[model samples]
Target: MLKEDLKTVNEVSKLTGISVRTLHYYDEIGLLLPAELTESGYRLYDKGNLLKLEQILFLKEMGFELKQIKVILEDPHYDMQKALRKQREILRLKSERLHAIMALIDEKLEGDEYMNFKAFDMKEIERAQEEFKEEVEERWGQTDAYKESAHRTSRYKKEDWQNIMESMNDIFKALACHIGEDVSCKEVQDLIEAWRAHITKYFYECTPEILSGLGDMYVMDERFTNNINQYGEGLAQFMDDAIKYYCLNRL
Candidate 1:
């Protein structure tokens, strides 16, 4: 690559409008890394890095959290063609929504007596987007890492599984009690650390990267959200935020 092909971190920030701190956070979580670092520790992103960042941003726009995007991008099965196809479907749904709203407005301008609120219904759009995201997640879940987790857990008897569930529930219950507190505080971060450790001990490696993905899953995956929220209202979201802060700043 030519020297001119590289752009500094600051230049990337200005061009992409992503904060410098966020870029650093992404680097920390193993989501995105600079193509090269100068002798003095300056980050320089090449075309490949920028292209990867584009994939990340595109997934982010589709409402997938940063951690989910990381997994999707890191998976060996990831294909830019597949991403483009997903983006095309999302955009088409959006365009249809816009056209529907426009037609409704035109009807109103023509003095229609009935008001149709169906144009604003988001259920179909949300359902399709969720399905698309799940498609990506399903593929990623079949990777060797997940298979490892499964293989390890499959050996456990019912009581062992019960113990694991109880242990995990205890963590959620404790986190629920601290729901109203600042998630970034040391107390909360310590809990986040324990949570990561627990997963590593019981299931898989649970590296900072994978832990971040679990954090997003707590909120994005309805099963997790529902189960976690049962401990306390909004507990899942609080844990998600705390986990993110812990991953970005602590780990």
Candidate 2:
């Protein structure tokens, strides 16, 4: 490739609006590496690297971790065109869901009692849940709890899943109410315990390890963070800290 066709790390960072630190970290993780290194020690990325970086960002938006993205990219049989098509479809569905949610909010503001039922309608929620489950399975399918949870939830009735979600939201909202307090405080720890118990009761047993991982996911995954933060600002990070404290001290 022509030297003029290559972009330096800083140039790529500026063009993509991604931080240089993140690009360096991606390089270190083998998720995305520069196409070449100049004799003067500058990292240069050609168009191919830029294309791979685009794929990496797309998968990240879909909640795929760097490791998973690496595996997907490294797979010889991976089809970029097919993956983009799939991503487009998923984004379309998500856009439609967001539109529905906005409409529901407007209806509620207008005092439409009958329209309230649409807010609780579990069809789209359940579909999104299933998609998340599949993504988790793809990422952590080897874990026993992942397998067990999949099997158990597959048998749940629509109503059961709805109740489970409602209970979870209640716990999240309760935790949000204590967001500014110490995470290790009795009230917050008790809520974390309740959250753990809720998971263990409905899904597979949530061991300390699982609980800790779930806490990390709450902060690391945008979907979980957005959902929890809907109750209050910073609630997801607060809940994560509370769960970690509960595991360390209470468990």
Candidate 3:
């Protein structure tokens, strides 16, 4: 029947890069079940199932609840095109945030143009800061560290933050070089200590746990990993492991 051209659970797992457990959970929750089951009880999915999975992944990444996601997916009136358009808008916001970060780096490389006679049409930096602060707060809740980071724009001059950003970038470059060679060396350890000291200056009451947590986030979160690994491959994972090791040893 439906199993004629469908793939087995193991085959689907390999093809989709989704774990077997997650697939089973989705089936149990009636989120994205296989199209058919063979006599031996092997789950089999068809091409249509793959399309549904793509939709499921898209909605999940956008932070939709499973119940809401199922309703939306099942609704014949639900327009995938419209949903994608909304996702584009969300991506635009994320792109603006990345642009702001790049602008800070650019300001470090190039002289400040704001002080010149040329007038700009908008306050891009302030807009970016507000949007970023709101998004981070909404997602992670307002932690003391995040609050401190938000108020940073007011406390320190733009030039100062630019300098810090450049310094941090340079440090990551150094770390990436070490990772390419050997991560468990004494040199890497010393550099990590310096990095820790640098971080402690801005973040309030920085602890080993917090530092290590950020390192893990660096690799786990695509944005952070992409930024850090711009210089080298696997650098983000190297940093995570190094930081975790340092935290366990030092703390």
Candidate 4:
């Protein structure tokens, strides 16, 4: 019995540019299955199945995990209009993040020529944080760390900045002597405390969670990783471990 909306698996694959194996897998997973099977056991998709497949591919391209998408699509209360609006909102957020990253890249390329580029020091960090306080407040809401950071930063001095850089280098030198030793040792912990004290001058109000996140950023951010690595080979990893240990236990 021929159906008006029916398409054989081969025809559907050709039309959608999806492989036959993938279609079979989707059928096996119950993500998308054919409405009918022929006398020869050939899979045949209907118009509704094709539409569902199209929606799945669209969601996939938009970064939706398969399980989340399945829940979204299968929900009795699912509204296509609402789903599209949510997707648009998320894409907007991604666009804004991308723009900010591009601006940072441009600042790096321009270096000293950047109009608002402040030298990376305790004073500049304080000033910049103050400038962005409203935005940060909006994101994190009222928190002790945020309030404390604002208070701590107001007292940051130029001499403090120079001491921080010196102390950081001194700590790195000490750690280099015992490269493979436990980073959580008392000696390393003290060095981390000194480093943390310096950071507190700029970002005193940050929570333990935020501190840990910054430790991850030290290695994840290529620019920061490069700076530490330039001190010595494997220095970046060592510094990452030290920071992680500090944030985990002592920060």
Q: In order, how many clashes per candidate?
A: 0, 0, 0, 1
Residue-wise C-alpha lDDT for candidate 3, range 1-251, written one tens digit per residue: 23466788788899989999988877765667676556797788877677778778867765655654554453323455655665566667667767666776678578765543222323544464455435433543445554554444235543564466567777878887886656668888877887888776753456776677678667665544654665578888988888877787765
Candidate 4 per-residue lDDT, tens place, 97-165, comes to 566657777777977455543222244333433433333234333545545644453454545533545
Top of the candidates by TM-score: 1
The C-alpha TM-scores of every prediction are: 0.53, 0.46, 0.44, 0.39
Weakest 10 consecutive residues of candidate 3 by summed lDDT = 115-124
What CA root-mean-square deviation does each model show from the true structure?
18.8, 22.2, 23.2, 25.8
Model 1 TM-score? Answer: 0.53
- lDDT of every predicted structure (CA atoms): 0.76, 0.72, 0.65, 0.60
**Model 2 ranges off by over 4 Å:** 1-139
Best by the lDDT measure: 1
Question: Residue 190 in candidate 3 has what lDDT?
Answer: 77
Q: Lowest summed-lDDT stretch of 10 residues in model 4? A: 117-126
- What does candidate 2's lDDT look like per residue over 1-251, in tens digits? 45798899999999999999998877655557565557796778877677778888877776766666665553323456666776676667777777888898888799887645554555754575467547544655565565566566556664574577668778888888898999988888988888889988876788888788778867765544655676789998998888878888987
lDDT of 1 by residue, 1-251 (tens): 56797899899999999999988877655567675568897888877677778888888886776756765664434567768787888788888999999999999999997979989988877887888778876786567666666566546654564566567777877888899999998888888888888877876687777777777867765544655676789998999899889988996
- Mind sharing the TM-score for model 4? 0.39
Q: How much is the lDDT of residue 224 in candidate 2?
A: 49
What is the number of residue pairs that collide in model 1? Answer: 0
User: What order do you get sorting by lDDT, best first?
Assistant: 1, 2, 3, 4
